[model samples]
Target: MYEDFASTLAATMWTDFDETPEREGPTAEITDIDSFVIDGNFPWTIITLETDQGVTGIGEAYPSPGVHEIVTDYLRPVLVGENPLDVERLYNLMRESLSGRGSQWGVGTIAISGVEIALWDAAGKILDQPIYQLLGGKTRDEVRVYADCHAGEAMVSSAEEGQEETTYEPEAYARAARLAVEDGFDAVKFDLDVPSGRDIDTLSRHFDPPEIEHKRSVVEAVTEEVGDDAEVAVDLHWNFSPETAERLCEAIEPYDLAWVEDPLPPENTDAMRELKRSTNVTLLTGENRYGRHGFRDLIEEQAVDFLAPDVPKTGGIAETKKIADMAEAYYQALIPHNIGSPVATVATAHVGATVPNFVALEYHAREVPWWDDLVARDDPLIQNGRLTVPDGPGLGIELDWDVVDEHRKTRS
Candidate 1:
């Protein structure tokens, strides 16, 4: 039965394979693509592509409004009936087809990213190879992960109407760091851009002296709490002005942070470069950016010490691997910014495993209890502070659809 399916698929999909030397083996045509929105800590957008050969591949898009529509309405037309095995070719096709419809950046690229990941996943399953192996093999067996403990249980997004206000005290930050360290993560991060009780003007994006001191105190507390047990990093969330960012960097420099992330907004690479010049603390950015073109200036201008491209947002696996390659040429490390489900996390890990410059992958769902339950695995995907790269075909993990349906949200 399997041989019959493969032969039928190849006959229908690879009529031109004999004419092209580079094309070989059986090909599976994508029959349908679907997406689901799970209401987890964040709205996790999961994608699946069905193939003619009875294979289905799963992927995750960076969560955003209208991602489901973008995937089904826009991208589905371009993907159905195409060869899923032609990963890069299909990726470029999607980009070129959406040229003016915001494919270069924003949610359009994000939707395409999810579909592209599905393509890779389907391709891997068809070829009976893991994604890392298809990406040229692994550099390490395990990928290091950093827990994004957002300012002592304070949600990165705004609090609910009836929820208690999140405290921005140093003690809270310290306790958060301690808990993460106790959980076996050797690297942890907290938000430094939280309410400092001394904000003169947040809309102006300026940090007054008192606010700077408050942020510095929080950093000191976390660093002191973790000590040698873990490396501490803080996120500025692109919330401050360049001058204020410089002051904040200067204040935290004494603690020897792993990296201070996104001090300034994503628009100005020149400002980021100047901020890098002004601070001794390691700077990390690129989560807001997309694709190699989006990250070109950051890499070429030497803007930051580390690049944190969100895999599901920045053109999926192949595109991110290309970005890492570009960053590698300039000696910058890849520490991907991930706020995704286990699907996106494991997909990003595949890229992390293959890249020579991968430093660590960000884990943002520590606060979500059912994060590990979303995947069908006996053991947790992440053990201690590291995730062992899966050697099984494709992503090496499957979604627990029962959990997904339980948490699934209605599309708006």
Candidate 2:
């Protein structure tokens, strides 16, 4: 079945290339391709495939510009003529070939994510089953999802910023958080930062003042309205001084946050370990991270209670699962980061299916209304705050190619 689908996909992509010759080129072409933006206007590259079996799959290359080029110019040749159903082998080939290119981070991993997801999507079509079926079957019918209202258009630029910085008022966040629970989500996440200073002493207050107080107030409001049944997580965004992380954790302890994410920068395992020592609240890390090795040092140091690597950033599905498994051994839960498109959410769901230690997955739904237009799906993989992994083959969603071309952004 995959054989037919691969042939079909190859032929269709060729037709797409021929019809839209301007869109074809090596990954380098991506350098010339325009950046594709939507809703929150986060730039992304959409990896699409039209299978011979009359099915299509979509994947995402996110958080970076020019990632499509990485997929097209850097990884396409290896992938174009290959079996889309051979998801694991194809992923390994890319990993081995691009080992030197921050194999588990940045553009390289993001590119791999696109290809891997495309393959998964293709396979699902081939087998007439969802991607999760290929990953040791689903452990649960519905994967739990958390509403991520931390910062939507507030932090990112939907339109160009003017002279002054945007003020994301506390009430705006509180409103977003409260609405998330009202919208039937069981959990919500918000953004917090470590304090910054002109000098070292001022650093102690990095997580202080307006940001801290404002954030705390937001969490408290949401927690109060939603009560104990609801969960809340704080994304520190890795701006913390270790001392500040510990201090902030103490301050937010009463809220009973589901976890405090990325208390320290990804590189400082020692700082994370130290912060964990004094804090009893749950610690989360790994979204700004990479492969199993990215978590190895942190795991070895016993730094966190939850490992939240984005599959796209951590060498795609398989690699992120490997990291999740490692975390499981250490009694840690794997709550993946899903700030990208629906394609990424599906890819991450496949991994969450196989990992027993899985907790909840992030769904930045506030912007979903805008981003959903990018995909062609009858029913969202998620419903009623739980993602129901499509039982159909490969990431199980189709791409509206017209949308990609419409939103394309070129930089080079």
TM per prediction? 0.92, 0.80
- How many clashing residue pairs appear in each of the predictions shown? 0, 22
Which lDDT value does model 2 have at 122?
67
Instruction: Give the per-residue lDDT digits (tens) of candidate 1, residues 192-252.
Output: 8887665377889986788888888888888888899999998989899988998888888
Give the Å error, residue 5, model 2: 29
Candidate 1 — which pairs collide?
A: none
The number of the candidate with the highest lDDT is 1
Candidate 1 TM-score versus the reference:
0.92
On the 0 to 100 scale, the lDDT of residue 139 in model 2 is: 80
Worst 10 residues of 2 by lDDT: 25-34
User: What is candidate 2's lDDT per residue for 186-224, written digit by digit as tens?
Assistant: 887877652222233544545445555666676676677
- State the displacement of the C-alpha of residue 201, model 2, in Å, after optimal TM-score superposition: 10
Badly placed stretches (over 4 Å) of model 1 are 1-24, 152-166
